[model samples]
Target: MAHLEPLDPKVDSIRILTLLPRVDNPNSKELFCKLENRTLASKPKYEALSHAWGPGQATDTIFINGQKVVIRPRLHDALRSLQTGKGRSLWIDALCINMEDTKERNDHVNMMSYIYSRATKVLAYLGPSHSAFNKADMKEMGESYHYFSERNCQLISKSIYWTRRWTIQELIQAKEIRFHLGKGYFTLDNRFNSLSNASNGSWLDDHLERIENHRNNMHSHLQQLEVLLEMFKDLECEDTRDKIFSLLGVADDTAQELIEADYDVDYYQLYASLIDYHQSASPLQCRSDLFRSSTYDPEPWRENWQGFDVSIERSVRVIAFSNLVQKTLNSAVNQTPIPESLSLGDPIIARGVIIGSVMSIGETYDDYVSSWESNKKWKALLESTYKKDKDLAKWRENDAAFYQEMLKWDHSEVAAIQSCDTTKSYGYRESQDDEHITREALDSVTEGAQPRRFLGTKGLMGFLPPGAKEGDQICSFWEACFGVVVRKLSEDRWMIVGRATVSKESLTPAVTESVYHDALNYGTENTSYSSLLSRTGDEFWAKQKDLAYEALIFFKLDIPTLQKLTA
Candidate 1:
């Protein structure tokens, strides 16, 4: 067994494998490689591999510098598949970094963004079932990804490479990226325009759509931490905290990570650094105890405060301006510069009052995602509850017009709710020729419901995030379309469970307005933001009205144990 050679502590210095060419002799068929130290400043040309080393033991052996080095089968296969040209080099994590050295591995992990961006090319190795790209996989330059068969598309979605947390950063950071699979290799230069399938169905379809969404986000440069977190929530790494850390490199917030992260990627300085980065998007900022001064505007964010993510402040979800923040901004007053409030991990002062509390909870997002039958159960529960509730006429008397308008639309006839389970049914229809399940809008309250639903303390219907409790207070941020759940931590300390909805009615497919549209919705600002007064609900933004912002806003901030925010 050969131990990995450790490099000196030069910050920019890195390890690379200068793989020796094939040995033609029949006696030794084993793949062999020799290690060498290279610095990025020297302009080393190498193919950086973005791969997953599965949980399996390192049972497969490859000779390194005439010494045996055991690696997981996945890496061994990846190495065997490589055709290292003479004098060409490779930087694959499994072999290049000294995993046994905690300090070395930590340093390299922090340098991942720099390494991938500097690479001549990046190969996202799918698995051992490797195949070389040919004319069949490459059309002209790279139009082949646009023409993959519906079946092949399914197979691409099923690839295990998509499940790794680290791959997300690799995908975003790669100078030029290619996907390798068993049947072939291809690179997507543009959005996936599948020539065959129009129906977005099955888990496979969800995976494909997610890829498209990933492309769209990158295409549009929507790399905010909240957006990336929501986009890649399902992705996993060995340490759950790395789920957040792995993404920091690609997030718009972390343009310059000046501080060294903890080995776990969560330390006091690093946490404060992230908090600083999150606030980088805020036009409403204080003088930097870190980073440059800003002419950064909150204008673009204003339009889509709820549509996109505002940063997370401590345990509280900071989506919109607190009413007080708006009032301060509106009144043009000084905040006395509570700079330490956030960076030191103090609770952000939320200025809004409690709108409601959890009264009754309903189906989980996973519940609806489990099956069509499960969503139908969600529908049945809501309809029986919302439609028949006589108390709505009393408690929500001011919202009479909304209830009446909803009843007129429901017509007391079509008893079933439309499937708004976007993950499962996004862009799906019964037939392409005819609209049988006539593809409902993805933003439709039915298509992208919250992870859960709950009856509010006021008998209003709204969203229920994962940890909502019976007495959790649904509080408001300034400009968001939805309200968040704040469970009392103590006398004044509160924990934001997540964004919850509190509307006039339950998850009904019946309403035209988003506030009352059974599912929690956002980005629907009209001439008037959704007020305490329920309007007709018809004034949705014209084009992308049905596009759901399906980001899970609650992430356990992987910071050093800090004090919870105080009210």
Candidate 2:
């Protein structure tokens, strides 16, 4: 391998690979390439490579400047495909960044956003092409709608190329993007144009249209963070911290400040900082125009808010009321009496409305034992055994022995039952019933401590606050996705118990009414809950109210109006 030059931090310099064209032989052991370092200030024109570094240990040999150089198999394939009759200039990370040098890696990473954004074009490599699309077939499918609908393309969409945290910014920040599928390259823009030319009104076109529209609707940095977290939650990275750091370049300026990329910081600290930033950020604002205007829907907002399934109608109503309240505040500022139809005493008028609640508080230890025994048919078997033997004492005394004899159990069970006389033990015994057993164990443990499992109005689950008993209200700010567990400290005050999760399902009207009543009953006697709002401050409350109102108003709109607004 040719001696690689160290990157000079004094000036912005990057290595561009000069890919040699393929020879006639297909089984050639080696490929040739040349690496040249150039300063970005000179405006070097080169295509950037965007790909997932699959299985770090798997590498292929390539000839760089007539010397053997080791490179990732994926990158070697990319170079072989991208090379043409004339050598192609490409800036690939594996070849470009000096991986052995930590300082070089850091500098290169920090400059990555700018590097990709300034690239002449970005070739998104989605690994080897599926056997379904050979050279002849690929040639015919070029820029066609069929090309995108191909199984290979679908695989490309789900590829690690699209899932990596670092590539999110790479794709979004690129000056232009092209897909390298095996040996074939194509542009999505060409596919869209081809579909437009056909005007066939196919489902593909409709889907593409939605995607284009969504892409056009650019999100703010904070909003992008929310989207990234949800979209890439399942993505893997060697360094857990890279999950957040990789996003800094593409993230909005404000969000970047919230989480500056620091490899030295622990991953948990990085995550905590992000949550803290979100919590401290001002609540959503209610736009009066959103209520009066017919073009609002709450789906986008709700999706952004929690990235969970939400009730469109309920979200819209909450937003409408929030917007209405904003108007009322405006009217009061102008010395006008609030409209009678929208009076403060109206049924809808409340400090905050319950959006969701926990499905079950939690199962007690007794409940857990009963459920398990019932599920396993142990209750009946034990009863029949006692009746047949006519010996209840033996049944109770040798319960573990009887359980082991009755059913095929595992080592864990044997251990758990043995420890039953001492410490608590719980775990899944089978793969199929793993989820069920895990949930039961979790519920049982929490319930044992008198912790009630409650859901936020918006469908989140968490425990009630410490010292919070059952039936205590779970309350949350309209702008906040999570809720708090609280009980009336007095007629006028409410004691904070701690945090609780939002429920996945919407609460029934009766449940909603009951929650409202509980809050109102205390609210009317004393301003404790009102003071709760005050704790977050009037500015924060107002902002939350506005967001809630906009969502509600959007929910009330007709489908056509909603589509038009979103469109």
Candidate 3:
């Protein structure tokens, strides 16, 4: 009906050039028009018949005007074959094969996902889409042949293998942490490894001092010195005497230096009392006791030799100094207990008292408890597990109900899926009605009691309640549906924290099924698919929250821990 215009020779030359191997052909201005008309033209009833063939015989193509675009030989042959077949025209790349051309191959390879996305029915070809296979074989094979064979070796070399290795291989091949092993057991990057192995640096001196002060005390140091002296008493001869003198500061030089200087204690009895005192005190007690015992031993007064009153005075002075030192030592041994409130029924307060009391004796609570409870049968079991596994104690100590609920919910959801009958649920009344009709027919013939007509379930049958059905309560109910709130404390974000189950019912059926049925319909029709997923999303998150709350009640965690988490 419209006038035909003559085509320019220059335009015709350009159109022909577009189909060549390396020609840069701009996209047709009318390409969008063809795309938009695709759905409209692709309806099954309006499909063209090839005298005997179905819509499947046609090849889908983007006709710029009306001329057939001259693509490569393989694709051209495929299009021609599709034009004669009974199968619906699927414009996917697997159907069109220009396997010889690298450039065309690369372009198509990138668009594979898009090709499947746009297809009327993505004929996920199993082996071959056109292959005449039986239904059994097709089902078994799956729709694997639908994927286009990728021959873009450059893309594979550059993008897939090289890029993937650069991103992920290092992490996958990295070393694991074995803290119980030697110091260099775990190795990550060179920097991290170096950081771990670095010295007990100058920055740590203050911390070291604090730690030393915490454990070091005058009375314990004195006790240790006595033990060390007893150990040295078993050593032999003049060498032992010199070594003892050097250790106790009676000698000027260390044993190694004295050996180098050829120093030896010839008159061992002159320092006999010093050696005896050093032998009495331990190693820890030796250094502190050195000055008073050996270095500053005063001689007896001249009057003491003649048995005069001066002898009594010298004895009295000695006794007074000894008494003073003994009193100071005794006071040091009796340390003050850390002040703390022993509030009744408070587990933290009880645990604190236990921890503080035990920590006074040992380096850590674990070390102290391991020693204190070693004889118990429960200790054997705990050690057996704790030695082999780190998480074992945590697993046992955790609320048993947390895992129990997880397994319970997992099985319940699985069972719910297995028991579901979609057709029956969707058409419950119709199916029941048909069943009753068939039963009545059979009953009349057999002369049994007449079968009754099927009646709908008691609660819901499109019947309105005594009042309105949809209102604020219903909207509020939907709003409160299963979801989790991720609350942020410092921020003013009011997140509905934790997993919640705000369904029509939980663990039990609702008292009124009418509200429940309406909610179910609303959920199925109105809610997004993400809102309905079973696990790991809003619904599952909400459920987890509720389960956590149940665990808190069941486990009876202390108020402080609970308050801290919720806050």
- TM-scores vs. true structure, each candidate: 0.55, 0.56, 0.13
* Tens digit of per-residue lDDT, candidate 1, span 1-567: 244666767547887887676657634447778788777677888889998888779898877788888888887767655644454588888788876677777778777877888888888877644243232543334322445554545555666777888987776677777776532356654224553343555564565465555545563445666556655667777754466568766765555653343464332333345444544544222212111235423453344344432232211324332222222122112212323443444322223345556766666544544567865765565555556666645544533433344334331111111121211111111111211222222222433444465556445555455545577766543334455555654442445444554454432222112221211233232321224124334443332244221111222222211111111
What value of lDDT does candidate 3 attain over all alpha carbons?
Answer: 0.22
Candidate 2, residues 222-273, lDDT tens digits: the string is 3344444444455555555666567667645334366565555543344335
How far is each candidate from the true structure, as Cα RMSD in Å? Answer: 15.8, 16.9, 42.6
Displacement of the residue 160 alpha carbon in candidate 2, Å: 3.6
Residue 460 local lDDT, model 3: 12
Write down the worst ten-residue block by lDDT for model 3.
350-359
Misplaced by over 4 Å in model 1 are 25-29, 84-88, 130-148, 182-184, 189-221, 256-260, 264-276, 283-347, 351-353, 357-457, 460-567
Local distance difference test, per candidate? 0.50, 0.47, 0.22
If both were scored by TM-score, which would come out higher, candidate 1 or candidate 3?
Answer: 1
Preferred candidate (lDDT higher): 2 or 3: 2
Best by TM-score: 2
Over 444-519, each residue of candidate 3 has an lDDT whose tens digit, in order, gives 2222211110001111111111111111011111112221112111221111111222122221222222222222
The lDDT, on a scale of 0 to 1, for candidate 2 is 0.47
